[model samples]
Target: MRNPQRLNVPIQLDRDLPEPLHDQLAAQLRRAIARGQLAGRMPSTRTLAGVLGISRGVALAAYEVLLAEGRITGRHGSGTYVSGTGSAPVGAGSLPVRASDVVVDLRSDRPSTQAFPLAAWRAAWRRASHQAPPVEEPPPAGLPALRAAVAAYLRESRGLVLDGHEVVVTAGYADALALILRARHGAGRALIALEDPAPPALRHALARLGTVLPLPTDASGARPDLVPAGCDVVAVLPERGVLGARMPTERRRALAAWARESGGLVLEPAFDGLFNPSLTPRPSVLALGDADSTAMVGSFCDLLTPTLRLSFAVVPRRPAGAVEEGLHGQPSVTCQLAVADLLASGCVARRAERLSVLYGAKRAFVRQVLGAYPDTRLLGGDTGAAAALLLPAAVRAESVVGALLARRVRVADLAAFCHESGVRENGIAFSYGHLDAGLLSGALHALTGTLDDHRLPRRSAA
Candidate 1:
């Protein structure tokens, strides 16, 4: 921790500004501490109120915002201290996970449903139920409050800066992709480029468009330069993933630039809270480049649960027209408002940060257990609910999966994720999201034991 010291800087606040005074003060403080203008210890709320000639409530509120973001911490007896340096970029995006049940689900996409905020969700649902009835059908663009809330969630939690006008609510991820495809014009089968080895749902969505050529990727995520020439649309998860790799900030910029230069659209997940909040946030692709050609599409499946079908996309200049023209069917108003309440109040961000930390611990366990096995290579990138291990060339993935299933432990084959040939290599996926600590450890042991027996057939030998 930095040495505790007093804040020494001039804080300017304009009362006439449309933004709230507390918000203004919070913004200035956030920037100041991040840029080393005034950091370490800060004055008490009462002291700040007097010093700045503002109400005590305003000062307290400003501190609360920073505290929520983990940018500042208030010592019980001591003053507030800077907790962050603001050197990392804020990121937004999500990778959709596929789910099923087993004694131990090793599938790469399952979320920890146990951690689902049932209490908070119940409260939000009740609040939504009490809202005033809508006289007319909600707008296709989604409830205004929900849109604003989504924007705020992105800004606070994901680090992407956007507003309500940029967001369009949809049923979910596939719907967002379909809407984008329809939003396009003069399309004789919308030629599209998809990140290789993506979720089957994504592939299915693109199937409704035109031919989807696989955009090549390595352990570092998809390559923007390899996007097919003349493709009308490109979709990718800008956030990093386990074995799924991540598109770096530079790659994101290039991809965003590619969209602009090629006049194509870039579709990405709007909110993926799978990343560890303890680390520096990665910037969304849209955040790094002109959003006029890029769209960030996401849903609450990972954030809340898979049952809540609501989703949103930060629409670009072109697609914004189609979205407003009824490209989407608005979700139920009550649910929308309830979600709006959560996002607007920072509940979603707080919950996501907690879950990320929990999952990060589980991920580390998997690494520590299986990382040392022969021919087992843990995939790169520390964000995602799932973990991937590259198996020895001799171990057959299908056999391993079958063996695990027979033993009541289910896992996913990397081949299952590959749509076109050559999208991924031989590997197996393990998910700890839905699994408890004890189950996960047992599953790891079973996995290592399975790998120990050379009785399993090798590819060439098979």
Candidate 2:
């Protein structure tokens, strides 16, 4: 067949940006390739390089990433071409590309729907349906049976011994947190300290409740000594999601002591223990600190699925109860009861075990790929569904993130997590919690490609 006319794919390179020139080239080419603009054959490295005013090595690097991702291929000498069959031509007559259609999200908050134990969940719901339905509005604190079950699950899974009455169910972490702040401070503004590099969404949510002081942190997670005087509450993620920081026993001890000495409340978002039969979690700050001065928020989103939005708060015993005096969003009794049954029947535990193995494999892939890169370091590995990589100083996390996102792989810069804008960091975070193994692998490779784009282009020895 005669070669199709060489297409005019608009490839722009801006050198002023922190994102590398090769990365910029790769992103535009990938976009064109996906649209079949480079359907049958692509320009040779030297030709494209000369045309674009970039080095041959730069063109070669872009091609290598696309090749690894199998988006394009090379014959013995015929140049690179799109790999898949039935690729549509770019431009008019072609379907318009929707933003949502092409994004491969790397944010790791949601778990896999396929991995959720559907059979067991359905069975639990069926059992819940068998029980007599409540005529009155269910208690905002949760159904008595569920509270008992939550307390039992906590004791079994987290080693935190508590009474059924102490577990107050809410719609999820947001509700649980809102209720906690209102109950303790009664809707009045209070001083709140949040971990530095906390999720921007969380910071916004807490901002309305009180002044949010950004608490600086290191590899060990949030610094306890920096809690600031008159701070009413300190929020920490024991799992330390994206930062990949694990609070050591000493750090936990120091936090517990801070809460004790200051009589301040410590808010810990506690995911349940690693479901692996062999692995039990270490003590939580809530478990180690004065229980009356600490509360641990728990969510089932990761344990089951975020769709089942039931979450609970293990309130400090000193409070008579977690009073949601004005709150109306307690989760449906059916969800609460069904999850309770899932826990009691060990369905949640079994699901945890399966997920442990699955996520372990995915996390290891992240470790092997991003971690193997000479200058990239993985952080906060022990507790959360998320993992963060600390990139070398030469590469800006924001630049790498932007370049990858342009290539259609959506990953986050640590700067994006800041409450205020324009903070720079050398770290980026992605999830192993609920993402597919394949999607996670591809995103990491694209990340590697973007990082490699920063290297000085190799020139011909001849």
Candidate 3:
């Protein structure tokens, strides 16, 4: 087939240009699309790369930026084409700007939907369906086999020892948190502490039932002193270590000690636990010396398919009865069955291993690109999954976020995560796992450009 006239894009790369070749290509393409210069069908990555005298990877990276932005769409076996208009392209703008619009979301906590192992999942589902039991009801807690597999996997990977019966499966992390809250604090209003800059969904979920307090963190993990005296339930991200320093052993011990003294329950939401490749694996609070007050919970949504709403919480033996009683009223038959098959097929384990490496590479790439902005600092860079860029205090985070959105770069501001006065920080969180190098570079360039264009001059210098 002949190339479409409108799809004939000429990307000029200057050797002297400080920007990377892939980023330059991506930015130019974005400009073309915005100006209606490149319309309808687009060229294949190979053709575009060959025409522009660049590597296929470079061309592909550029294409990924467009894809991430929803400027283009891929047809199986066919070439890429310009996406239809009406809704703004993905990453076209920040969250608030595109509040009602379905933008291609780069700020999502979930893994990239495109990279999901659909074939493996489908095969597993088919096999499980054929081997379906006479009854449609899920196993009491979950499919026993799946629970056992999860236990084994966690033991091997995360070093958490658990019996299959101890693992209670739920719809997702949200549901699991709800169940845990209900189990631990039935009718009583407990003071719950969470990270200051936490995932908004978590804050909303916890706020609905209890007095949610935002716990502050510096280079170390959540400060044990910051955890209010009256609070009995503290929710924390287990590995929120700063740049070079891991969460100190002393700090963890201190937190445990505090929990012990206060009679508080420590709920560790181990988000993206599987993706870390550090030599000394970050231990879960639940794994610390058989503490009866701590429970470790993990969600497969961020690591696997978000649509597959299966999460597990390793409850302390003390709370087992409470958890069981709380979950008795909820119906989760289909969810358990699907999760069981997913575990039995070994697809989750395999994919998780692969994604760990994939996300690590993407995280490194994003850091390399975003590192160009001297004024910006990356939070959680050592963790190799999600990082937040801390902008200068003078910069308007919300406006900058909106500007990025207009350019199709989706990101979340720290303001959304803050609670009460004197806790505001000028920053935004970026999930590197969901984005590739090319898209990341392009987005960074656009974001920096927007910030530069709008940033106020230093008052001292002025």
Candidate order by lDDT, decreasing, is 2, 1, 3
Each candidate structure's count of clashing pairs: 7, 4, 9
**In candidate 3, what are the lDDT values of residues 87-145, reduced to their tens digit?**
33334442222222324355766574334555576666666666546455564466677
The candidate with the higher TM-score, 1 or 3, is 3
Give the C-alpha miss distance for residue 343 in model 3, angstroms: 2.8
In model 3, how many backbone clashes occur? Answer: 9
lDDT of 1 at 197: 70
TM-scores of all predicted structures: 0.72, 0.73, 0.74
Q: What is the C-alpha RMSD of each candidate to the true structure, in Å?
A: 16.6, 13.3, 7.4
What do the candidate models score in CA lDDT, each in turn?
0.70, 0.70, 0.66
Clashing pairs in 3: 69-90, 90-104, 91-408, 91-409, 92-405, 92-408, 93-405, 93-406, 94-405
Better of 1 and 2 by TM-score: 2
State candidate 1's TM-score. Answer: 0.72
The best-first sequence of candidates by TM-score reads 3, 2, 1
Clashes of 1: 7
* lDDT by residue for model 1 (302-336), tens: 77767778887777655334566536476788889
Better of 2 and 3 by TM-score: 3
After superposition, the stretches of candidate 3 with alpha carbons farther than 4 Å from their true spots are: 1-104, 132-136, 163-165, 241-246, 289-291, 318-322, 328-335, 455-462
Which ten residues in a row are the worst by lDDT in model 2? 272-281
